[model samples]
Target: MSREHWEPVTVFTGGLKPLPPEGQMTGMYKVRRDTPVFCDIEGLRGDAQGDRRVHGGPDKAVHLYPADHYTRLAELMPMASNLLLPGVLGENLSVSGLVESDVCIGDVFALGDARLQVSQPRRPCWKISHRLGVDAASRLVADNGLTGWYFRVLHPGDIPPDGALELVERPSPGMTLARLWALEQSHRPSVEEVNTLAEAIGLATQWAQRLKNRADWLARNV
Candidate 1:
């Protein structure tokens, strides 16, 4: 496989205000387009994460959703197709080419002048269903493993809306976002699987710890 592939960033979205009260999603719903956003170790300078507890931090400095997934989702859920537009799902960067299956944990990429590392697969929540007004939106994302991915800023810089995201490094013994999502959804993940993921080089610390805890629990139960 090619060591690196480039993708065009289709949109750059940021917002400080919360979503509509009726939706009950409550987080930067009004994502406006910006030419280029200043990325720091924390995140976008102007972007605000409505719920800091579950979203945003150094580990999840940026949220990236595949532009291709939107098209697939539109076909799957025609009723909520209108809500599948870029930034509607609260992603900071919407890009084409790199999808869950292609992106691996710990992979490093140069996005414009900014450098980033893939941290974890996005864990879809109730907010997604609420935002789309479809009760199964979250479940669908989980099942399909199209939940997007998070990035941790390695070298803070400015990223343009149409910037080219180029993979710079891909670590060995890596786990793809799609595989990680599948392991997470498994009713009973093998101890080896849990241990492997827990020790994955590029995985987010939180996810790694969670996998370790799950492994411990299974060891105890079995």
Candidate 2:
């Protein structure tokens, strides 16, 4: 079978800084870079996370937000269209062609010299709303299934600013990140489906635990 590939339009990285309104530190405002960056077990060398508890780690190393989602986001929030741009979503790699619907958990890819595995779909947070200046921005992304995904470094190496992200393997071909996100967000999810996803290979530990907990809750309450 032929593998899928995509070239990132831009690579971005940023340090944590105090954001307004609450002065909470954030690393969600990244700027484009023109040079290659090192990708290690933690993440891009210079990338910083305001809160490590939920943001950065081996299971959530690199973030890739599809460039195409910006257009729909702009339409959804015309007032903040100016803020809806590539790299603004705090993604490390801003690329088009591949979106959540096309990517599945356990899928591995080669970019530059690094090997990365799809860990999970990004869980939209209040930071997104704060970054975009739209109170509904986070919810909009979640509802529309536009939430980008994170990658866990399987083989660390330097990632260049320009190159195609080539698929190396797909272990769970039918479990796309979009489907997982939808199932997870559904108010009344199926116990069987939740249990299956909780054991999905390459899925982040935290997400799997959450799914398992949800399954248990459903078993008792539903």
Write down the TM-score for model 2: 0.96
Q: Residue 200 in model 1: shift from native, Å?
A: 0.9
The sequence of per-residue lDDT tens digits that candidate 2 reaches over residues 1-222 is 578788754789999988767989999879788888889989999999999998989999999999999999999999999888898888999888889989999999998889999999998999999888899989999999999999999999988987789998988878999889889779998999999888889999989999999999999996
TM-scores, one per candidate: 0.92, 0.96
50-166: candidate 1 lDDT, tens digit per residue: 678889999998888888899988887899987788888888888877788888889898887899999998889888877787889888888888899889999999888777888
- Write out the backbone clash pairs for model 2: none
lDDT of 2 at 197: 84
Candidate 1 whole-model C-alpha lDDT, 0 to 1: 0.82
How many backbone overlaps does candidate 2 show?
Answer: 0
Tell how far residue 65 is off in model 1, in angstroms. 0.3
Q: Taking the candidates one at a time, how many backbone clashes does each contain?
A: 1, 0
Report the Cα RMSD per candidate. 2.0, 1.1
lDDT of each: 0.82, 0.90
